[model samples]
Target: MTATGTGTTSTLHADAVRTLTDWRPADQDQEQLRLDYLAHLAEQPEGVYRSCLPAHLTASAAVIDPAAGRVLLTLHPKVGMWLQMGGHCEPGDADLASAALREAVEESGIPDLTLLRENGAPVPAKLDRHQVRCTGKDRPENTHLDVQYIALAPAGAQALISEESLDLRWFDFDRLPELTDHSVRDLVARARRLTA
Candidate 1:
C-alpha cells in the first residue's frame, strides 16, 4: 500500500500495484499522448494554466464468468456503488489490458484471470464517458477512454475483497441489484454478449 514514486496512491497490496504499473498495451500512440499531456500539466506551476487542465483520468477492467452467467463486482467505498475493478492508468504501464488485469487480480483475488480480446489480438477499446459526483465547491468532471475487455474466470472462483470495496460477489445477470450507474449495467450486458 506504499505509494510508488510514479504517483499511484492506493491501499491495495504492493504486488497488485506493481502488476498494474507494469502493464503495457501493444499500441503506443494513445499511451504516448497521455504521457505527453500529463507531462505538460506537471511542468506548469499552480496558476491560470493549471486551472484549465483536466482533473480526472482513469482505466477499468471487467471480470465476467461465462459458464455461470455472472460477473464479479465490487461495491466501491468512495461512491458506495457497485463497479468493475479498475483505477487510474499509471505511468510506464504498456497498455490498458495489463492495467485492467492487474486491477482485476487485486480486487477480486482471482489469480487465474484471462483477458478477452478480438481474434486473440489486441484491438484498441472505445472511449467510455462517465460522470462523477460534485464535491461541494469542486464539481470535478471525469471521462475515460476505457479499453474494455472480456475476462473469464473459472467457476466457483472466490473473491478476496480488498479494503477499497465494501463487498464483492458474483451476481447473476438476471439477479443483478439495481445499480445506480448506467455505465456499469451497460458494461455487464456487453460482457455477457461477448462471452456468449
Candidate 2:
C-alpha cells in the first residue's frame, strides 16, 4: 500500500479488477473481495505496481455502566457523527489492539481501561468491511479496511475531546443521537447485544 499527503492508494491487476467489479453484494461477498485483493497483491511482481491502500485501524471502547445503561461516545467532526473512539493505525504500533488502546486513552481521559474479548482474550476479529471514498487529492479511489474491537473503560470517566472530535458524552442505548453513519450504528448495536 502507498500513502501520500492526499491519501492512500492500491492498484489491482486486470483480473483482480474484473473480479472486484463482477462481485455481487452478499453476506460473503465482502470477505471474498478482501481475499481476492490480498491474493492479487501476493501474486504481483514486487516494485512493478505500487499500492496506495490505506490501512485503517480503529479501537472502540464499550464504556458500559450496566446499572446506568450508558456507554461513552464521541461526536466526530469530519462525519459529524457520534460513535466509538478510534482512528487510523500508525506505524510501529504494537498491534491493532494497542492502537485502539492508545486512541481510547487519548480521546477519553480514562487512564484505567480493560480490553474484553471472547474468553477474556485479546484476539482480533474482522469486525466489518467498508469502501470509503477518498478525501485526499493524491488518490481519490482509496478505500479502507476498518478493523474494530470492543474495549472496556471505567464508569463516570471524563472525556478529553481532541481536535478530531466536537463533543463527547455517555449516552443511553435508547437515547442515541441521530447518527450520520449506518455502519457506526451497526457497531453500536452489535456491541450492545454482545455486552448485554
Q: Report the lDDT tens digits of candidate 2 across residue range 1-196.
A: 4322122322223322343344343357456745645554355422112233543323345455544667678887755678777766444343456666777777776778666566555533334455544455454554454445556666665666677678888888678788736666665665676667
TM-scores, one per candidate:
0.66, 0.66
lDDT of 1 by residue, 19-83 (tens): 22333544475456435434433452221111323433345777888898998989987778888
Give the C-alpha miss distance for residue 196 in model 1, angstroms: 0.9
Error of 2 at 8 (Å): 18
Off by over 4 Å in 1: 1-57, 123-126, 133-139
Error of 1 at 135 (Å): 10
